[model samples]
Target: MNETDAKVPVDGSPLELALTAWREALGEAHVVVEPDALEAAQTATFATTQRIPAILRPADTAQVQACLRIAQAHGVPVYPVSGGRNWGYGSRVPAGDGSVLLDLGRMDRIVEHDEQLAYLTVEPGVTFRQAHAWLREKNSSTFITTIGGSPDASLVGNALERGDGRGPHADIFQHVCALEVVLPTGEVVETGHARFPGALAAPVFRWGLGPVLDGLFSQSSLGVVTRMTFWLARKQPYLREFFCTVNDDAYLWDAVDRLQALALDGTLKGSFFFWNDLKALSVTQQYPYASVGRTPLPDPFRDQFREGFGRWAISGALSAPDAEIGALLERRLATALEGAFRPVTFAPPPPDGESHFQGVPSEANLAMAYWRKRTPPPQAPDLDRDRCGFIWCSVALPFTGAQARRAVEIADRVPRLFGLEPNLALLAHSPRCLYLVTALAYDRDARGEDARAHACYRALARELAQAGYFLTRAGLQAQEASPSVRDASSEVVRRLKAVLDPRGILAPGRSES
Candidate 1:
């Protein structure tokens, strides 16, 4: 090749030569190796001492493939991240230390939009807020499903991790179609029908001929996704929000049983939430340090907080073709939920277009990290920069009342054993199974606090698994706490990883189980 190839070695290569080639492939300015830059990128919300060697900003598919080729030739492992707002998970931290970070944030591009087919093709750097604004600019009626995390979170990264979102497309992965992935060996290929030349259904069809390979790339260390097509949900004429307070465990248990039919049938659309009082309060206000005057807030005070705000708050949305059908769905909800719990109330979506069902992105819910923070929350929350200690342990359970109640009891009882509050919730995104997501929040600056918080996390994961509920999505810390999570995958993933990434260079140790 030309001088831009940066001279590959005939045998084993040193990391310096690989770095030189990376700077040649991507510009020198995009290849960041500054001490402060690597330090910042390696920092996670949770406690971690792993150091990142460098960060590479690839602007397009060609540059990404080139970077991968250099890393492959030199035996330098690299991890690709989009927008790097993983937050409560691991943020931008890779599975192992000393790996070069491929920051895909510079590849922000809306490649294609087919309004007729109802799909939007985007580069890896495309975020929730960017897509929302793009839809508004085009005056398009359809919208992509959005997550409750940072608006800067990537669409492709979240879908690859099998994240949950709002609206009829609650399961984000279910709404995605074609994928453009750059393999570890420096080859790029398309998934589904996109692999075919001049295939008209590339963006619309999910499965191509032969064996299904779409799921292999998701949550794996197999390849770096450069582009993805997200199927959009059309606008509904009628939209209404349903919310209620559940004070009694029995009442909440029964409600979980009743709500499944609504979701399974057609009464409720989109992902709904059933968060505890701590989750509700954290979103609106910081931890009441002065009033509580303690860590973990004693049982008496905790009970009072729950009593005032109700033990749990149930919130979801209902959508239909028109107001008449919307009203009928409302009646069905009231009949099942209104008797024991407080009256299930309905309201029209806010005029600002920021409603959960509207698929608009917002940073409002990230305040939960500051629940234990001593300082006041900023307009934009940066957990790592502010040392906001947090870890998410989410597990799946059957959509039955007994299962929900038992999981809740275990989650509620275990955290207190570690002197940490059980900031827990049940994200009911599907009818058959719901995730019991628990957040472990603490002050990382305190002495021995990181160890305490991590020990608490391991306990939560172990006990929850013992109760027959395993983690749905795990972070870097989660994988370490429970190695079983990495091994939870089938033998196919392990065998495929050997064939696709023999040197273990691409996102090493990610989604192993």
Candidate 2:
């Protein structure tokens, strides 16, 4: 048989032998091989042609180990998914077609919640909503960092993908303390102090003694993360939303510069998003495709947005321990913006509402995924379930007005070249640099639009990489952006993959591997 031809075979074949072992390891109830279920699992938030034969629902670390061992024995590749909410990034699809999907959603459990230490150790199935509700039930004083994606998205899954959230812990992967991973070879290992038997500081201390290995699991198919511990941020006493605008390029440059300075000076603790008007408009309402006649967002729509929200709209929050500190931080932010930009507005906290900085997760951000859809968005937007074609291409840029301008300029010009409107934002994770995140939204069901959207995404990624703005995080569709093996660092990554997973069965062709 060909090496890559792991497709399900006729009855009584080696593939059936592997399935028999899997069913024995993790009961018949856990095995999913029906055609409808497999087809549903194959669907992604974006367009893809990959096929999956079956999904293995592993309930624990031992089950994960058993599945891996079975796959290794039968030479059937297996892929792992935490919550399968990766949306826009290929969802639950495997790296290669015909690979068995190992779903960890059945392992949802909050193993430990140390109230004093402000840490939560959870399994791969634990979601943001679950963690939040658990903390509330326990009346804990801290909350988990939440992202703009689905609340049902697994924390370990997002952390493994290096996804950003809305609070001071916006850098999700950096905040995780320890990880319990099951290797592709069926060995289970723990990072940091967790490696030591009965080590008390396992969940608190990040670096135990030797070289740090937690980062190795992130953005790589090095292992299957069964459990992880995240250091939660303390709930602040006061939080307020802040908004401002830059009507043109001249003001946008200065605004970004001053915000970066404030972020560096410790005045801006949480993430602040600087979104272009097109993004703001999309989230607020869908594009009027009927009125626009399918060319692009008509000039009238652009003019209307310009009148209401200028060229660039900035929104974020300021959180503090008390009113006194909050007022001082607000004053500092204002002083940084004084005379540099106009029409800036700072609003007090709305009555009885939790802000994103307070670790509240919401699905409102998913509205942009349906911007190009013909049907109206549902009351609760579920993009993957709805089959919306959305692709996120994010790259890193130095936190400077010049760099931000160039990145946004390319973002604007490239999408237009492909007859698509650019939905763009500059996410400020720190003062040193920011992530220039752009999404290409289209209708997946529309004939030929998927190819168009894919082409536009490739073009944008290629141009952005060539312009010195390289991708910090990429979807499965963006694997083509990976550097060639000719680069010394890339060659090193290839070597590491060979050492860790010689079979190349753990998420083949993933980032830097």
Candidate 3:
């Protein structure tokens, strides 16, 4: 057979060929090729600050399949993006190298909401807020949701990237039920038993029956995830959030150990996070529940607001009956706070009183609140004076007090070389799975800021990689700066690409050169 038939066709006019194939394979409304419209569509997604891709909108799975087939035939790379709101990570935009950006926003749909099973099946275009709003509107009081940095972020994208949430089920990756993917070969595959005969609606607990493929799509450019199902947390009757303060930096690791133990033993119902004083103030703005605008803590507790206070706070929920909640709280507090310094517990105040731990709006959560205050706000922090970019380095460290302390030391000192303070956050995947130490450096935005920020991040990433720490999500400069992890990750990714997209099409330069 000639090359055209042996493989796919690649000789015709690229744009004409793609448009024609799309028109025949999909409806007219699915294709967009206007230059201005394409640029606008590409920029709408996150993480495309420096580099943008050629935009392609596919309305449904057939369109996606046709686009992938044409790209594979013509050796054109394709990057699939969902909500385009992947922040801090490479965002939804593809890394540069001239690829066809497969926009999934057009496929937004909620395919299934099994209230009895407590799971939601949705397409990549579905956002967290949209899903939550749907659940509320449906009057399905059976499920509660845990969302990431922005409610606008795509549920499938976040889960595929292993994003975390502030609930008992912290890791989004762990909650994945099933996936509907359009692969590079123009074939649509449904993972999990939904594809099996007589199991169209099987519960998604049969991974052991075959090689698990759900994980491959995560953090990979192999395929476009059109739909996914994930488990949701059950709504509780009574929930409470509490903020705990630790005065000494020395006790930070101990506090984490205690918190982890509590979490593992079911003492802590919700997620717990630790932040330094700088991050705390940056997050809350109002310190110690006191200031001119907000109620102020008295002078007796003034020292708590001081710098380097090493704040260890947790939001706890009491889900059981009244009799059980009180007893559970007492036991949990006693065990979790044992032998720690005078740890102050700030619970929701009574009626008409200032409660440090009110059921604050969901937006008041730590991560979102911090970003709102510190990240490029409208009227605050002259970007010229307080201009800062972040080089995020995170790793799965061993879960021990000694290891945590050592990691903290490394986290603290890594940023000092650049005259920046380390902004640290702890992510507990499970009771004993992995403790992620995320360190962020503030690079003042000035002339040649990109180069400087890139250099610092490269150095930090290289050092961590050399010490046997694997980066969860590498930054843009990771390949040039931190060759250890980047080189290894790139190699594995290349091999996977060859097997999945042998025509050198799907996200070409993303993995293999």
lDDT of 3 by residue, 1-513 (tens): 122212222457664566566666665665554455444433311123333334667777877888889877766667788887654555544665556678888788988877777778888888876776777678774443455355667888888877767665667778776688888998887777867767755455637358788877887778888988877766554444555666666676777777777767776655566665545554555233223222222334434555334444433443433546756665676567655444545344244211112111143333422231224343432222233344456676765666667666666666566544455666666776444444343333334545654665666666766666567765344546534433576677778778888886766445322
The global Cα lDDT (0 to 1) of model 2 is 0.84
Per-prediction RMSD in angstroms?
Answer: 4.3, 2.7, 7.6
CA lDDT scores, all candidates in order = 0.85, 0.84, 0.59
TM-score, candidate 3, is 0.80
Q: Write the per-residue lDDT of candidate 2 for residues 45-115, one digit (tens) a residue.
A: 77776677778998899999999988878877888998888888888888777788899999999999888
My TM-score estimates for the predictions, one after another, are 0.95, 0.96, 0.80
Clashing pairs in 1: 167-270, 486-513, 487-513, 488-513, 489-513
Residue 236 Cα positional deviation in candidate 3, in Å, after optimal superposition: 1.7
Clashes of each: 5, 0, 5
lDDT at position 479, candidate 3: 46
- Off by more than 4 A, model 3: 1-16, 23-53, 206-208, 285-323, 338-346, 349-388, 437-445, 475-477, 481-495, 511-513
Give candidate 2 misplaced runs (Cα > 4 Å).
1-8, 339-342, 350-353
- Cα lDDT of model 1 overall? 0.85
TM-score of 1: 0.95
Mind giving the per-residue lDDT tens digits that candidate 1 earns over 307-330?
667888898888888889988999
